[model samples]
Target: MRTNALSTLSFWNTPRIGVARMQSDMAQANQEIVTGRYADVGLALGSRTGLAVGLRQKSAELAALRDSNNAASLRLGTSQAVLKQIQDGADATLTALTGVPEDKRAGVLKDMAANRLGTLTALLNTSAGGQYVFGGTRTAAAPMSTYATSPASPAKTAVDAAFRAAFGLSQDSAGVSAITEGDMAAFLDGPAFQGLFAEASWGTTWSAAGTAPLTNQISLSETVETSASANAPALRKLAMAYVMASELGSANLSAAAQGVLTTRVAGLLGEASKGLITLQADLGRSQAAIAAANTRLESQASLLDAQIMDMEGVDRAEAKTRVDRLSTQVQISYALTAQLRQLSLVNYL
Candidate 1:
């Protein structure tokens, strides 16, 4: 190694090097004391660094699953709540129609069915974290189109066409009073019934749909079907009932005619109520699975936390001791450096 010829320059370099080393050591000790983890992370882990890395990765994986589980749980809960609302709505309409005078049944029944249809549409279009629950991978858009003049609302158009085809006139035709249950049943079972339900005319109103339901992986090799499609049978039944009740509202039907319509609609709503039971149960299963996954992930996270602590954590008492020792050493090094600076050839003389 080449040497500096001047002794003063050499003396200056030595003290600076000593002070720098002491400062580095002191900083490391201070960091360990403040952080509760070894300052020399890489060196401390050494050959075990890979294990610690794997443990941390596992922790992160569990955390990700927990976050997904939280969102999924809420989504499942929302679905269940909506199902209850539908069931209760159907029940209320049925009870009201049964108790009302036959002469006043049409208006009361129409309002109830119309309300049910709108509520169900809103529920089906609900999204979890911005993803539509019933859209079957078409998360960006609502699952149902409104029953209006819009071309996309084939369900509404079909229902209107159905009324014309069945009565040979508008739904408000006074001749509607002459109709029978057979006529209502025919319409209910016919292709014209598609107009009131997006699921019935899925491609037009509820586009990007499929039979395969939405899902999420709850655990390794365990996945859950998260939500049912908009075309669920129960929904279809409700839509049919709602459409009939709504379109029949303006019809100047007689007492017998009102009884036939309301009675048929009440029966259909009852069936829809029954069908929703299965859907609610299915959604509950998904919610339960998410809860179970959350529990397992929490246990796994605790273990990972322990592993990480063993790999990197420092005892607080030990760390404080180390910081105190390094601080004393640093003070001694400063004193020695100052003493050495005074020992030049001229100072010796």
Candidate 2:
């Protein structure tokens, strides 16, 4: 008469809670794998990549500026080297004028003239990577007109005429006057010559003379004056020395004047040699600055590359491991949930 009362039982549902928790854990792992981040998208730790990216962009900009600065510094260094060579040649000319015998003076003068012409050509046609360095942005045209080997020949006359036409100067007007001692010092020490030496232009012109011989290119301006009673120190000295050399070669000057000319030439050479020492120092400093700029640019580029890598580079192994773990966790959660749902009192009996 005892009957077994089987009460309707609720299905075991604890697996549902385990399934939900497993799904949440799997989703979090999947998110980390997809985003390659260990923190939430908008969290503080997640901002590191963005900050690195910004820093990298800024570094790239600085690197570009530094590259431009390096290029400019290199041009300046090249220019300084050219100037130093010119100065050395000038010193050599002074030495030749002062001490060489009268019989040999003409040959030395010719050599000096050739050397000076070479210097002028080098200055005007200065190039870096095949682009003109001193053309002041005019890369197509030669800075100095082609030199004529013979100053008195027809070819020389034509070349001179063409040069004058390009520069808007008349043949007769293109001449440099003899400089006095005071004028010479002033030109060497004054702003006008200083500006010229610095490679600055006088308005639109690259040089002051056109279609004129090198001897006719007086560097000093006309506004400068000298007393009639006293000889202009620098100008007269140069003129007297040049005249004496020419006269000696032509056998026109007295022996006493020739001797004086020789001594004067020596003194000029000594002074020029001293000047070269100063110029070389300047060139050295300019070269050092260029090297420093180049070094800085290279260092900045390296730093920028590192910063960029930090921003976007990925760890492939870690990412793959996270994805595999998430997949396994999801599978395990589904299996457990199914097993829990299957558990029933009737099945147990």
TM-scores for all candidates: the values are 0.85, 0.45
Task: Show the lowest summed lDDT stretch of 10 residues, model 2.
Answer: 222-231
Clash pairs for candidate 1: 155-195, 155-196, 156-195
Weakest lDDT window of 10 consecutive positions for candidate 1: 198-207
Per-residue C-alpha lDDT of model 1 across residues 1-349, encoded as one tens digit per residue: 9985767667667767877887787788788878878888889889988888888888888888788777777777777887888888878887887897877888887766777777877877788787777776566777776654445366666666768877787777777767776776576656666444544365565444454677888765578988777778787778778877887765477666666777778888889889988899989878888888888888889988988998899898887786688678778777877786887778657
lDDT of model 1 at residue 112? 66
Q: Relative to the true structure, how large is the alpha-carbon lDDT of every model?
A: 0.75, 0.46
Instruction: Write model 2 residue lDDT over 60-90, tens digit each, in one string.
Output: 6666556555555555556556656655665
CA RMSD, predictions in order: 3.4, 14.3
> Over the full model, what C-alpha lDDT does candidate 2 score relative to the true structure?
0.46
